[model samples]
Target: MLIEHLTMEEFAAGLERTRTVLVPFGSTEEHGSHLPLDTDTMQAIDVGRALARQRPIFIAPPVHYGVCRSTFDHPGTLSISTETLKALTIDIVAALYRQGLRYFILLSGHAGGTHMATLTDAGEVLLQRYPELRIAVVSEYQLAAESGRELIETAGDSHAGEIETSRIMHARPELVKGTAPAEYPAFPKGLLVRDKRRFWPGGVWGDPGKASAEKGARIEALVVRELRTLVEQLEAWQDS
Candidate 1:
């Protein structure tokens, strides 16, 4: 069930049954030229809803802002500071912690390294504060990347790539325009530049030409399965 849609009485009843909550995070950032800016958010919410069908958990309202460094100059990309994202995550989880929820899965659709790191840091902070808390910071992208490695046709498919495009195609086809040409950014390794878009003009990191709804459905199912397994393990955690 989604926490945002639950009434106080319904929330209380849910708490009596389960303390597990899945908090999905995504970015209001660009996803190449074809896909919607909220692609990450949409995919995260999709996974949460899919997982909920097979398990008992509350889905928190997704965090739509993330610290987007590479896509900062891209159109429709709205980024918050790294500190802000971290603090927001900590505050949200802290609020949930006080509400009798103990198990948390911080699932982010935006899998940027910095964004994931900030979430991991927040999970650590929550754990430090509430030792009984059972938390996991993860991204369905991690599972999709691993599980769909063989199914994907594109090399180094990451952002706005075959996999992501396919997932969006399966989940929200109406939001997609025609597919954009495959592109790989040439950002300087171990260096920072102000003109991020110049190095990656198209804002695509992999081939979108190979994306298909069939592949997307399979990948999404795989990710949901892996997440279910993760939740089962988290639920079995016992204080030592």
Candidate 2:
């Protein structure tokens, strides 16, 4: 069940069954010419909802901003610093723990390196404060990447590429403007440039042409299955 829609009594009842909660984290960064800015957020919460249907779990409201890099120069891309993200994450976990939630799944749809690091770091802090609490920081991509490896044709399909395009197509079709041409950035190794958009103008990392709604549906199902496993693992954790 979605925490926002649940009454306080309903939430307390859910807690009695399962103390675990999934908090989706996504970014307000530019996806490409086609996908919506909230692409990551939409995919994340969708997975959370699907998982909830399979089990009695509560899903917290999604955190819609993240530490966006590489695409910072792209239009409509908004970012937060690592410090801010860490602070927000820790605060959220602290609040939830006080509410009797003991298990946390910080599910981020944005797979940026900096963003994921901040989340894991926050999980560490939460653990230090409450050693008995169970927390897992993850991105759906990390759980389901190999599952889609065969389905995707792009060599390094990431960002607003074939896999993402297909997933978005399946999740929110009307929001997709149109398919973007296949493109990749040419950033110099170990050198960060000021005009990042110059290196990656189209903002597409793989061939979106290979994307199809059929493939997207399969991918979403795969993600949900993997996430279910993760939830089970978290609940079964035992401090030795």
> TM-score for each prediction?
0.98, 0.98
Off by over 4 Å in 2: none
Candidate 1: tens digits of C-alpha lDDT, residues 143-188: 8998878898888888998999999999999988989999988888
The pairs that clash in candidate 2 are: none
Clash pairs (backbone) in predicted model 1: none
Count of clashes in candidate 2: 0
Query: Per-residue lDDT for 210-231 in model 2, tens only?
Result: 9999999998898899899889
Show how many residue pairs clash in every candidate, following the order shown: 0, 0
Q: Model 2 — TM-score against the truth?
A: 0.98
